[model samples]
Target: MTKRQKRMAAVLLLLAGLSVAAVLGFTAFSKNMMYFQTPSDIAGGKLPEGARIRLGGLVEKGSVQRGEGLVVNFSVADCDANLPVRYEGILPDLFREGQGVVAMGHMDGKTFVADEVLAKHDENYMPPELAEKLTTPDGKHSCAQFKSMGGST
Candidate 1:
């Protein structure tokens, strides 16, 4: 073949190999992608049953209940709605009522069967997921600014 024809063939082969590599990379990433949802989203029937997902929201006040076994029940809320969750394991030290948490598990009918529970790290800091919702465009918690200011009584 002519030199010009050989050069063109080599370029075409390289392009084809790059396209195949891109497709393979995308396929692998898509399979590993896990989405997080709020309690309201689950209540709205946006998620399918038996699908693995991360559910994040505030732990509902007065909803935590301890059973005889390791099983425990609690309700997670996103201000607009709440979801009941059941978990069988030791609770995290930071887990408590009225705090942000993310539970990873599958749905069993209306209840979320959590295999793992992540709680908020500190009282001053909000969970990353929940903080995003509470932050304004200027990157500040809207509610936190309104908190009482210290002054002489």
Candidate 2:
């Protein structure tokens, strides 16, 4: 091949390799990235369908339901708003209604299909995000208004 043709072919090959690398990099980043949001944020239509995200809130009272051996359905709420969540597989021992939880999953319309569930280690330990959201402006949890179901007060 002529010198010009050889140089042009080399440039095209480099561009093609760079494009492949970019596509692979983006795919890897998307697979690992996660965004956290409160139930209110999700209720306001701020959720995307494909990205894995965290929904942090209190498990709503009277919203836990068991359908099959390992399938459970519940709702996450931030006092003012609620988002339904569906999770399969064994749940944590600390999982229960009225406790703080953060679910990682994607939104399917109004429901969050969680692949993983995280609960507080004990009643004295609550997720910081949930604590901030559940407390009043005075820096205290309003016992009469928003008491912990079982999570830390």
Best-fitting candidate, scored by lDDT: 1
**Models, CA RMSD each:** 12.2, 12.2
Itemize residue pairs with steric clashes in candidate 2.
none
In order of appearance, the predictions have TM-scores of 0.58, 0.56
Candidate 1 Cα outliers beyond 4 Å, as residue runs? 1-35, 122-153
lDDT of 2 at 63: 87
Per-residue lDDT of 54-137 in model 1, one digit per residue for the tens? 887777778899987999999877646678999999888889777677799999988999999988443566579996677444
lDDT of 1 at 4: 98
Error of 2 at 121 (Å): 5.0
* lDDT score at residue 27, model 1, on the 0-100 scale: 70
Clashes of 1: 0
lDDT of 2 by residue, 1-153 (tens): 999999999999999999999999977674234345666666655344666788777787788999888899998876666789999978888787777777889988678999999884334567899977775442123112332222211
